[model samples]
Target: MRSVIIATENLGKFREIKTLLADEFDVFHSLRDFEEKVPVDEDSMLYIENAMKKARKVGDRFGMYAIADDSGLEVEALGGRPGVRSSRYGRSDDERIERLLSELEGVPWEKREAVFRAYLAFYLPEKQRCYVFYGELKGIIGFERKGVGGFGFDPVFYVPEWNRYLAEMTLEEKNVLSHRGRAIRAFKDFHNVRFFRNPTVHRL
Candidate 1:
C-alpha cells in the first residue's frame, strides 16, 4: 500500500502499531496524519466486528489501506464486564483501574483470571479485501499496581510466568507476548505473504 492509516485516536495503540510497522514500512502514517480525525465507535460485541467497522470507515475516508484494532481485557470473574468497553469504563485511567479493582474486590487471584485480546482488521480498498487477525494474553489481576511500564490496567495485570505485572516489563519485553504485539506481528506476516509481494510499493 502507498499509504496507511490506523483507525484509532488512542496514543498508546498508535505508538505500538507504529513501532511494529517500522521495519516493514520505511515510513508509516496513521489517522493522526489527517487534519480531522476519522470517527468510529466500538459498539460491537465482537473485537473483529469492531475492528472491521473502524477499518472500513477509515479506509474509505483516506482511500488507502487502513488498519483498525479493538482490544480489551475480559475478566472471568466479572463475566467479561469490560470487554470492548475497556476504554469507556471511566473517564481516566486511574478511575477505570479503580472501578475494575472495586468490582473485582474480595475476589481471589485465581478467580480473577483475565485475558487481554486484540483484533486487527486491515482493509485494502483497491483489492476490496478485508483481513482480520487476533492475539491474546492470559493472566490475572493483582491486588494493586506492580510496575512502572505499560498503559491501562497493565499495572494490575499479572503475568505468572513472568512473575510480574505487564507494567513491570519494558516495551521490548512486553512486546514479546503482549496481545497487541502479537496481532501487529501477525499483520506484518500478512503483508509479507499477501501485500508485500509488491515490493515495488514503497512505504511513504
Candidate 2:
C-alpha cells in the first residue's frame, strides 16, 4: 500500500479528495495528520504557483507524493478582485461574503459575470516532477447568498448552467459541475493514464 498526502489542513477539501482517490490509492493522509506543519507560504500571484509550491514543499519534506490545490472566485465587474485572495479577503466567511456583496451592490446582473476557478498540483518527490490541472465554472454572482451546501464563496456564486447559486446544489451535483471537480477529474484521468505503465507509482 502506498501512502500519499493531501497538502491541506482543510477538512472539507481533505474529505473530497480522499473520496475522489479512495478507490485508486491504498492509503491517504492530509497535512493535518502530521505532527509538524510544513511551512509553505501561498504568496504566489497565480493559483498554479501556489498549488505547486504547497505540493512540492510537502512532498519534499516527507519524501511522499503530495496533492494540493488553490481555488478562488473571480468576478468580472471587480476586475478579478479576489483571485488569489479569496480565502484572505476578509477575516471570516461571513465578512468575506458581506464584502463581496457590498462590492457588487450596484452591478447589474449582466455585469455580474463571475467564474469559480481551481488549479490542482501533484508533486512526486522521487521523480521531482509536478503535474498541474485547471478548471473554471462560469456564472454570475448572485445578488444575495442563496444556498448552504458548500463552503467558501458557494452561497454567492451563481451557476448559469444550473440556474442557481452553487450553495443550492447537492454535493453530488457540485462534484459534477464545480471547478474543483473538473480539475480533479482531469487530474484523475491523466494520472490513470500516466500510471498505467508504472505500477509502483500511485497518482495523487
Candidate 3:
C-alpha cells in the first residue's frame, strides 16, 4: 500500500486519521512514528494556513505525501475567542474547561453557542499540489463538563439536538459528526472519486 504521513504529535489525532484512511493507504505519523521532531510555526491566524505550513514542512522533509490538521473551538459568546488558541486556552486541560465554564457563567443557554472548526491540508510533494478541506461541528457550551470519553472541549460541548456532550458519545458515534472525521471523510471520498474517474493514475 502507498504510505501517507500525518504531521501531528497528538496520538488521538493520528488514531482518528488512521481509522478514516485505513482502507485507502498506510497511514503513519510524521513525528511520533518516525522520531522526527522538526518544529513548524503555528502562528498563523487561520487554521488553513497553519495546516498547510505543517503539511508542506513534513512533506518536503520526508519527500512523501503529508497531511496536517488545525482545529479549535469557536465560541460565539466569547466573540470567537480561543478559536486558534484552543490548545492554549488555559494552563491545562482542566483549567481550559474551567475558563470556558467561567466565561459562560450566567450567560443564557441560548447565547452560549459554540462550534468546533477543523481545517485539513494535504501536501503532495511529487505532484506539487496542495488540497484543503474543512469541517465544523455545531453545539452549545454546557455549564459543566460531562462524560470522560474525549479530549479537549468534548466534555463541555453539548449537542443540544442530541442532548449529550461530545464526550458522552462513543468513538464511532463521535466520528460521525467530529470536525476531524468529517474532513477526513471528505478528503477520502474526493480522492476515491477522482481515482475512479482516472483509473490509469494509481492512487492509494
- Comparing 1 and 2 on lDDT, the stronger one: 2
| Per-residue lDDT of model 2, residues 1-204, tens digit only | 878999998787887777777766889998878999889889989888899889989999999988899989888899997988998999878899999999989889899988888888888899888888777899988889897887788898888878888889887788888888888888878855554322122222
Question: On residues 1-204, what C-alpha lDDT tens digit does candidate 3 reach at each position?
Answer: 588888987777787788778887864654787765879989989888888889888998898889898999999999998999898888877899999898888999899989898888888887766787788899999888899987888999998778899999988888888888888877876775442221121111
By TM-score: ranked, best first = 2, 3, 1
lDDT of 1 by residue, 1-204 (tens): 355787776677788887777776555676767897776876778877888888888888778888888899999999997999899899988899999999989998779999999888888877766787778899999988887877899999999998989999988889888998888777776666645322121111
Model 2 regions more than 4 Å off: 192-204
Candidate 1 Cα errors over 4 Å, as ranges? 192-204
What is the lDDT for 100 in model 1? 94
TM-score of each: 0.90, 0.91, 0.90
Q: List the residue pairs that clash in candidate 1.
A: none
User: On a 0 to 1 TM-score scale, where does candidate 1 land against the true structure?
Assistant: 0.90
Candidate 2: Cα lDDT at 125: 90
| lDDT, residue 27, candidate 2 | 92
Clashing pairs in 3: none
Error of 1 at 61 (Å): 0.7
lDDT of 3 at 49: 85
